[model samples]
Target: MFDLSQFIFFVIGCLATFALVCLLFPHLFTRQKKFYPKRVITAFESRMFTRLKDAFPHHHILAQVAFSALITHDQIKMRNQFNRKVTDFVVLDREYNVVAIIELDDPSHIGKEQEDAERDAMLIAAGYTVIRYTQIPSIRQLQRDIR
Candidate 1:
């Protein structure tokens, strides 16, 4: 009951239908570009220190930590908290206003007490609770602060 001519037409029609479907929904065959979050790298001495910001406790123990522990959605983390920008590592409140600012400092920061005071003042003026930590804080200290 099968005719060769008819079989050829059916095959062509099926191929055409598939091609039409592909054209209508190109995503079926085309690859979409993947999205990636931007990582900010600074040129200061803390460039090395900043990279450690993303590291976890015992690296093997906690592979992934909560975003609330490190990241904010409103603004990107800035190297300087109070100078040119509004604040660094700013966390917003329920009202969507800045609530907290975290500053990371190197050992040299010990000599800049006046500068630190001024930066803290600026952050406080903008209603942000600023917490400055050493470039190499102990895991215990970081855990306590994060908590």
Candidate 2:
């Protein structure tokens, strides 16, 4: 005896009202994001470092650029390693497969050759090419090896 159509219309009206409120004041329905303050460097640091890297002149000044060049020319990609993983650098192919694991050895790595070799071996076992760059060579050298 009761009207089923009237109940359906009432439910639809409530849903439409909620949707309208969400559309008008979208942030209200959403939970407020809490900010956890902490001292940490961000990707902005990398951009700033990139700018600084331009002004500074050194042997490896062009390392970042060389990485980009390799990607552009040979269809590769380099991503920054945030985790303190064994590998310092990872090179990926167009298919996102790790093609190379590069380590830029500076003074800090002088006495750790054996340890580094072990890491390289691990990467090799995983089917990745390992490249250790002690001295940042010229662009020509980078092109020869990367391509």
TM-score of each candidate?
0.36, 0.42
Write model 2 residue lDDT over 78-109, tens digit each, in one string.
Answer: 12321234444444555555545556677878
| Over 4 Å off, model 2 | 1-84
State how far residue 103 of model 1 sits from its true place (Å). Answer: 0.6
Residue runs of model 1 more than 4 Å from their true location after superposition: 1-39, 42-87, 93-96, 136-147
The candidate 1 region of ten consecutive residues with least summed lDDT is 57-66
Model 2 deviation from native, Cα RMSD in Å: 12.4
For model 1, state the Cα shift of residue 14 in Å: 85
lDDT of 1 by residue, 73-137 (tens): 34545433422433234434445454445566656677888878886775565455666766656
- Backbone clash pairs for candidate 2 read none
